[model samples]
Target: MRRRLSFFACLGVAVERVMTDNGGCYRSREFNAALAAEGVRHIYTRPYSPWQNGKVERMNRTLALEWQYGRAWDSEAGKASTLPAFIEHYNWGRPHSACGGAAAHAAHRRRKQPFGTQQLVIHAFRKSSISM
Candidate 1:
C-alpha cells in the first residue's frame, strides 16, 4: 500500500491516512511498518461495520455508473478526453446524496476545508503526471 501510494505523490497529492477493513494481511507487521515509514496513519475500520466503509463504496458505485459502464469510448484517448469532464461534473455539478445534496466542491467550500480525499483521487485517471 505504501508503494502504491507513491503514485498519488506523483500527482501532487499527499496521502495522510487510509481507512481499510480489518483484514489480516493489512494488520501484518510489514504493512504497518510501511505505512509508518510513509508517515501515513493506518486506520482500521471496525470489524463487521459496513457504515465505516460507506464512503469508498459510494465512490466506487458512482464511478461505475458515471464513468465505466455509462458510455462507450471509441478509443483510449476518447475515454481520456471525456474523463476530466465527468470528474468536473462530479466535483462541481452534481449534488451528492451524502453531502446533504450539495455538490462536493460546494460542500467543501462551505466547510472551508481542503478537497475531499475521494475527490482528489480523480487525478489517478489522468494519463500524465501533473507536477506540484
Candidate 2:
C-alpha cells in the first residue's frame, strides 16, 4: 500500500476521494486516518455489488486469468521476484486490440497522431533455436 501511495504521490495529485467497498482494510481506522491526512474522502459501496468498481474488478479478473492461472512457480520468492518483469511486459510488450493493436507504451507515444497519418512501425526478427 505504501508503494502504491508513493507512486500516486509522485504524480503530484492528492487523492480527493477513494471509492471502495466495505473491505476490512478500507474500514480500518488507520487507513481512514491515512486518507484523512492525504485529504482524500472514502466512499464505500454496497456489499456484493462489485459493479460499483467494475473497472478494477474486471482488471483483477484479467490478471488472474492472463498471468496467474496454469503457471508453475518454483517457489514463493520466484513468483514475487518475477512480478515486476511480468508487469513490464504486460504494459509494454502486449498489444491490445482496444488500443488498435499497439502496446500501452507505444499507444501513449502516438496518442496525438494526426488523422490518416503514418505511425511508427515495429518489426520482430525471430532467432533460430536449433543448429544443424
Candidate 3:
C-alpha cells in the first residue's frame, strides 16, 4: 500500500480515500496505519454488497475474462509476464463506457487539468493464483 501510495504521489495524484470490502487484510492494523499515516480515509463497503464497489468489481471481472482466462498458458511465469502488457492495452487501447467510448489514457489526456479535484481511491485485494 505504501508503494502504491508513493507511486500515485510521484504521478502528482493525491489519494484521499480508499474503499474496500470487509476483507481481513484490509482490516489489519498495519494497513489501517499506512492509510492513517498518509492522511487517507478508509471506507468499508457493507457486507455482502458488491454493488457498492461495482467499478472495481467490474474491472476485476474484465481482467480475469479478457486476460487471465482468455487463453491457456504453458506456465505461471509466462502468464505473469503478460500482465503488464495487458494492463497497458486495457488502459491505453480499449474503449470504456465510463470514458464516453474513449480509452482511459486518452480520456485523461483530453482533460484540461488532469488529477485536479480528483480523489484517488485504492482498493486492495488478496492475490490469487490460477492452478494449472
Best by TM-score: 3
RMSD to true structure for each model, in Å: 7.5, 11.9, 2.1
Which whole-number lDDT from 0 to 100 does residue 86 have in model 1? 80
Instruction: Sort every candidate by lDDT, greatest first.
Output: 3, 1, 2
Which residue runs of candidate 2 sit more than 4 Å off their true CA positions?
Answer: 1-3, 91-93, 96-102, 105-132
lDDT per residue, candidate 3, 20-50, as tens digits?
Answer: 8887888999999999999989988999999
* CA-lDDT, candidates in order: 0.67, 0.59, 0.79
lDDT of candidate 1 over 31-60, digit per residue (tens): 789889999888877899958877655665
**TM value for model 2:** 0.64
C-alpha-based local distance difference test score of model 1: 0.67
Q: What is the TM-score of each candidate against the true structure?
A: 0.52, 0.64, 0.86
Index of the highest-lDDT prediction: 3
> How many steric overlaps does candidate 2 have?
0
> In model 3, what is the error at residue 35, expressed in angstroms?
0.6
- The TM-score ranking, best first, is 3, 2, 1
Q: For model 3, give the 10-residue run with minimal summed lDDT.
A: 123-132
